[model samples]
Target: MAVLTYREALNDALREEMERDDSIFIIGEEVGEYDGAYKVTKGLLDQFGEWRVRDAPIAELGFAGLGVGAAMAGLRPIVEFMTWNFALLAIDEVVNAAAKMFQMSGGQYNVPIVFRGPGGAALQLAAQHSQSPEPWYSYVPGLKVIAPATAKDAKGLLKSAVRDNDPVVFIESEIMYNLVRDEVPEEEYLTPIGKAEVKREGSDVTVVCHSKMVHQALAAARVLEKEDIDVEVLDLRTVRPLDVGAIVASVKKTNRAVVAEEGWPMCNVGAQVVDDIQREAFDSLDAPVARVNGLDVPMPYAKNLEKLATPNADHVAAAVRHVCYAD
Candidate 1:
């Protein structure tokens, strides 16, 4: 095992996948010459050359459509947006063209494309650039949404996303690029998509979260432990085909649940999770399923306000307390 930052792990994943498959290529703004906006593609251009690591203009829609076309032509393409906020410009290609091609053609075409980049709020990027769009893509049936909270999961899941025969929207946290690290395996391995893993085990309550929220949940679990509240942390690595079995099992064991997410509350991923729990594990729940989510309003631009608006360990711990009925 080798310790690697989230950014370096992603870089390794792309490098390894491209090395194994001749048809896989990467295309995005500044991906080649500038080495990507977040430097996740650093040194890839020199390794694969301009042909495979081609740079596109600052046009998300055009380049994204090109990727979809390339995928339909039997070449796998990794499309990176500087940030998901910028990907709003390319939703048409992502939702309509790439996602619908296979189903529309009755499985005649496979859109093996991965659209990835930093998502959700970071620092004080403000409302426009700080929005979380996971629910938007996950709402669509044809698209698979993946958000990995750890370096190891990011590397393995990305490799799986690239090889998937369907359109995938891979969201990364802007703040966690260099902030999070993990010991990644040296040998090749793939983290199965549509599975949830219990990061920490307990019996008092279950704290379910995904992406960056997983870290917050883990921290909250630590805080609760001091007060004699055993909190279990479950990370939903894949947001689309959610591991309902895992969720139900954890909720049954704990008899309580609190969902944490970086997105807004209205029709958010948490909302779906709550609904699923109520329907599938209604008898197991001891209290109402609670949610700790980003403020319903647009993300604030002020530093202090941003901190208050985003969900954190304090927020998650409070939600856990509410579900567990603890002070």
Candidate 2:
């Protein structure tokens, strides 16, 4: 095992996958010459040359469409959007073409491609740049969505996503890329998609979350521990093929739950989780399922406003307390 940053782990995953499969290639803006927007693709260009590590223009629509076509031709392509906000321009290709191609064509064409990039709010990316689109893609039928919260998950899940035989939306976060570091296994491994991981176990309450919110949930759990409240942190790594079984198991054990997410509350991932919990573990639940969601407003330009809009440890703690009836 080696302690690595989220960026380094992702770099390792891409490198290893490309090395293992000659057909796998990466394409996006500044991916080759500039080494990626967040330097996640650092040194990949020199190692694999410009052909494999390509840098496209500032055109998301054209490049994303091209990648969809390439995937149909039996090449595994990794398409990076500078940010998901930019990927919005290419949603036509992602949702209409890549996502529905296989099933729409009766399995004649499988778009084995991965669309990845930093998503959700950053330090002060402002309204246009700050947004979380996981629910938008996860709502589709043929697409798989994953958001890795740890370096180990960042590496393992990415490898699995790249190798999967379907379209996947691999969402990363600018807030977590370098801020969170952990020991990731050096051996070749794959974290199966559609599985949830219990990050920190407890008995009082279950905290459901993914992406950067997982860090906040962990921090909140630590604080709650001081007051004799045992909080379990459940990371929903894969959003689309959600590990509903894991969620049910956690809720059954804890009997109380709180969901944390960076997205707005309405029709968010948390709502889906809440529905699942109420249906499968309704009798197990001791209290109502509470959620710590992002402030239901467009992201503001001010730094403080941005902070308030994003979910933090304090927000998570309050939600957990509410579920536990300690608020």
Candidate 3:
């Protein structure tokens, strides 16, 4: 096992996948000659050449549509959007063609393609670029939505997404790419989609979250432990086909649940999880479930305002305690 940053793990996955499969190639803005906006694809162009590691024009819709077409024609194409905020330009291709192709074709065709790039809030990137669009993509059928919170999960899930038979949206956090470091096995591995990982175990309350919010939940759990309030933190790695069973079981033991997410509370993935828990484990819950989510407003450019919009460790801890001890 070697310690690697989230960015390095992603690079390793792409490098290995391209080497193992001839049909697999990367196409995106600044991916080839520029080595990626985050340098995750650095040195790939020099090794794989222009044909495999291509730098497409800044037309997200055009290249996304091209990637969908290529995947339909039996080529495995990975389309990077620079940032998922820009992916709005290619919504027609991603939501319509890529997501609906296999089902529309009556299963005769499987678009083995991966649409990836940095996603979520970073610094003071304001409203447009700071939006978390994973829920939007997860709403569509035929598209697999994945967001990895750890270096190991990032590497394993990317490989799994690339090799899958359907379209996959592999979202990475811009902030976490260089910040978090963890041990990643050198040998190839794949974390199956739709599985939930228990990052920490406790018997008081369950905190379910994804991506960077998972880290926030874990940190909150640590603080809660100091206050004698045990908390279980679950990382829902994949958004679609969410692992409801894992969440139910955790809530069953703890008798309390707090859903944490980076996005707004309304129509968010956290709401879905909380609904599922109530439906499945209503009797087991000792208190009403709580949702710790971003403020229901556009992210602001100011650092303090941005911090207030996003759920932090303290916010998660408070939510857990409120849910656990509420009368």
Candidate 4:
């Protein structure tokens, strides 16, 4: 096992995949000469050469469409947007062409590609650059969404996304690139595309979350541990094929749930989790499911307001306590 930073794990995944498949290439803004805005693509240009490791002009719509065309022609492309916020510029291609190609063509064309980048609020990037747009793609039927909270899943899931035949949206967190460290397997490994990993097992309450919110849920679990409140933390590794089974099992054991997310409360991924929990595990529930989400307003620029705008450990912990009636 190797203790690696989240960025290093992603780099290793791309490097390893390229070695195994000559058809795979990476293209995005500043990904080559500049080594990526977050340095996730550092050293790839020198190793893979200019053609495979490429840099694109600052046009998300154009390059994104180009990548979609490449996929239709049987070339595997990893298209990195600077952030999912910038991905809004290319939503048409993602939602229309890449997602609808196979069904639109009666299974003749499958756009097997990955659109990846850091997402959600990081420091104080403001409203334009800080929103979490995962629900937009998750709401679509043809796309698969994966958000890894640690280095291990970051490595394995990206490799799996590269190998899959469907279009995948891989969302990373800019603030977590260095903050999270995990001992990743030295050899090749691939996390399943539609699985939820139980990070911590408990019997009191279940906390469902994904991406950076996983960290918040884990932290809340540790705090509740001191108060004799056991919290089960589930890292929803993939968003599209929601792991309803894992969530239902956890809720059956705990009999209460709290969903924590960085996105706005309305129609977010958490809302879907709540729907499944109530539908499948309603009889086991001891209390109404609680939800902790980012403030509905646009992300603020001030550091203090930004902190308040996002969901944190305290908010998550309070929700867990409220559900368990331990507050």
lDDT of 4 by residue, 92-181 (tens): 999999999999999999999999999999888999999888889999989999999999999999999999999999999899999999
TM-score of each: 0.99, 0.99, 0.98, 0.99
Candidate 3 to truth, TM: 0.98
TM-score of 4: 0.99
Error of 3 at 138 (Å): 0.8
lDDT of each: 0.94, 0.94, 0.92, 0.94
Alpha-carbon deviation at 28 in model 2, angstroms = 0.3
List model 2 lDDT by residue over 83-136, tens digit each: 999999999999999999998999899999999999999878789999999989
Candidate 2 whole-model C-alpha lDDT, 0 to 1 = 0.94
Residue lDDT tens for model 3, 191-224: 9998999999998999999999999998998888
Candidate 3 vs 4: which has more lDDT: 4
Off by over 4 Å in 3: none
Q: Residue 221 of candidate 2: its Cα lDDT?
A: 92
